[model samples]
Target: MAKTKKLAFICYPGQETFIEPIVREYEKRPQYQVHRYYTDQQADVIAAVKWADILWLEWANQLTAVATQVYEIKSKSVIVRLHSYEALSSLPTRVNWKVVDYLVFVAPHIRDIVKMQIHDIEKQVCTKIIPNGLDIDNIPKNKVFNMYDIAYVCNLSLKKEPAMMLQIMAELVKFNPAFHLHSAGGWQDKGCEIYMKHMAKEMGIEENITYYGFVENMETFWPGKGILLSTSFHEGHPCNIMEGMARGLRPVIHNFIGAKGLYQEKYLFNTVVDAINMITEWSATTPDEKDYRKYVIDRGWTKKSMMASISKLIRLCGKKA
Candidate 1:
């Protein structure tokens, strides 16, 4: 009989983008059998835990109930990946570190912030900074052109600070009359959506702004964009930034504390004027698309590289625990 390592991933439903790639990678390997469990019912969660040798709770919040069930998680090696929003939630304080052998944070700043909030438990757990896998292999490198159409990827919610992009665009237009802002991703609330449109018109930049509601396939959407701009106040290393870089878009990331650690310092910005300047500078040149793509792949952020590392981590952690 062939030896098989059973793995169960319990994730919050909306985060399928992160989970799907890993699951696909595992399925390709004969040595692994993967099961996906969403945190819905207590009984189902327990059954899923019982079936797997390794259990990776995709969000710390998924462990809110499972952490309390000492017996259920006792036999399985538990690892939890914490994103930025969950670092602020009650879930961090509630995780049973004795049961969870490892904690994975998407960004170092998120790990640091959550450690401050969770206190004693943070010290007890072995943690690793793991970015969610991104594959640009299928995304052909159609490097940027000097003409201006700035793209910001992520949900158009209040938290992502889409309004900040508008503020930056207002400044960019004063210099580059052709500059436009493309906002893509689901708008969480209709009220927030309505407000953004109203605010853009009020600021007299409505024609320059376009809201693309929930991009279904990025391969179709990411091509030939001028620059990838992020105005998020908080992030766990935004995927849009990585996707933008992979698609050969110049990244203009508003400094979200530790984003400078993730990208070159030159790409980091503090003010709308700085963002406008970066946008203009990139527009006026031919960015080294090969360098950006290589940088992402070099960091082991690609689907295959990250999956291989993740499998190694799970097995190693399981053995150590």
Candidate 2:
């Protein structure tokens, strides 16, 4: 009989984009047998934990109840993945770290923040920082569009700060009237849509902003822009930012945790005004497309990097036959 290492992933519903890729990657390896369990279904999750050799958790908030059930079943080798928003919001939740063997942070800053919040659990939890990666072969090359168009592809959420992009666009239009902003993502809650429309109207940049809603083809959507903007308050290696870079879009992002060490110092901004100024100046003296693409590719977010980190983690857990 072949050795089988059973893995169960517990994640939120409608998060296929985040979970599917990882599952597909792991499934390709011969030694692994991965099963996904939705946190929405308690019975199914409990069953999965009982059968799994390793349990991988996506969100920390779901850990409390799930951990209790897993402990009752005596589940082994658990890994919890923490994102940026969770670091800010999930601190007060009653989390049981004893059930988890390792905590994965998408960014080092998130790991640092989590350590501060749960200092007492330091001995029980082992933390690892793994940045999000892109499938280089799948990312399409430039799908040419009109020049001077900026793209901001993210969910229109309060945490994403889409309003900051609108503010920056308003400033950019004064000097470059040809500049247009393209947004491609859906709003999860009613509050997001309300805030988004209010910000657009308040800034008088509503006309320049085009909302394309959810995009199914990121390869096509990403390559059609000259610049990409990220003004998020926090993030765990944002997939959009990595996708943008892979597609050859020069990113003009705020100084957030995951992006802090990735880009040049000039790209970092403390305020929206400063971000606008920097992007405007950079746009005027845009580097050659070849050079820009090379810069993004050189940074280690490829499939190899992602797999290496994941494999190392599995080995550390002493992968059982």
Candidate 3:
């Protein structure tokens, strides 16, 4: 057996959700011992880094350590995964990428943005596109496709454009009055959720849009929804899209920053009208569940598939799995 190495995973605020599934899978790996450093306990972060053969800074943001502790990680192999928001924040500019053995990206769009925005990034900075992993096997296979019910999952935020989405939904009602939209997820403090609701009210489609704030079990939202809508101005490969697919909701995703590179053209759309047309087309001729299900499996979103990516990541750091 390979020597058991201690692995440190540090999670920042919003990151806990995306990091949990990966931590669960890594804990199951026999070759490595996993230590999860939830957030800012400076001493814990330092100790975890010291004890770890490889330190994985879950978010490129905080928990990767402030600049002072950043130097401590220079002696050890470090892996940092950067999501979309961090690229725009001060986080990327703060990191010393030279010490990082591997930089992980949830999607290519964010990767391109980071590369362009960050200053003095190491020429040899090794990067990998590891989409967020989910335990699909645990998500029960049940869906109630109410053709009129459309679902949007993700916290209401400027980037998510809840108001714009409501505007589109309002327009969608014109084509099909029975077309109801359900959005599950809380409002980010800066999201202007009230403004979005105001827009819904102004558009006179407030009743057509049902807001179920902060849903714990998202699978329940997918059933009875004919189309899953993703209108985020940007994203880090959201779980909702794949989870919606798991429940067999035909996905209608907007052209997010770099979504085209990651997803098929058939699913990506340029405008609300385009997405509406696509959903209409899907309704006219439904897709084979088996084919879409297979598509999700092949993309390597499952816990089993993610393990393979982790194994490769271990190898990249010159460790045995």
- Model 3 per-residue lDDT tens digits across residues 1-321: 568878878775555877777777788878878888886777777777778878778778765636225556777777888877888777877777777888888887777788787634536478888887667778654444666678888888788867667767777788778888898988886438768877788888988989899998765566777778888887877788887776677788888878777678888888878887877667655545555566678888776776678668876674521
- The number of the candidate with the highest lDDT is 1
TM-score of 2: 0.89
Ranking by lDDT: 1, 3, 2
- Evaluated at residue 213, the lDDT of candidate 3 is 93
TM-score of each: 0.92, 0.89, 0.90
The lowest-lDDT stretch of 10 consecutive residues in candidate 1 is: 61-70
lDDT score for candidate 3 against the true structure = 0.75
- Residues 56-166, candidate 1, lDDT per residue (tens digit)? 787777544464375867767888877778877777777777777788888788887886776666668888887766766676777444449777788877888877887
Worst 10 residues of 2 by lDDT: 64-73
Backbone clash pairs for candidate 3 read: 144-224, 146-224
- In model 2, what are the clashing residue pairs, if there are any? none
In candidate 1, which residue ranges exceed 4 Å CA deviation? 62-64, 67-70, 143-146, 317-321
Winning model by TM-score:
1
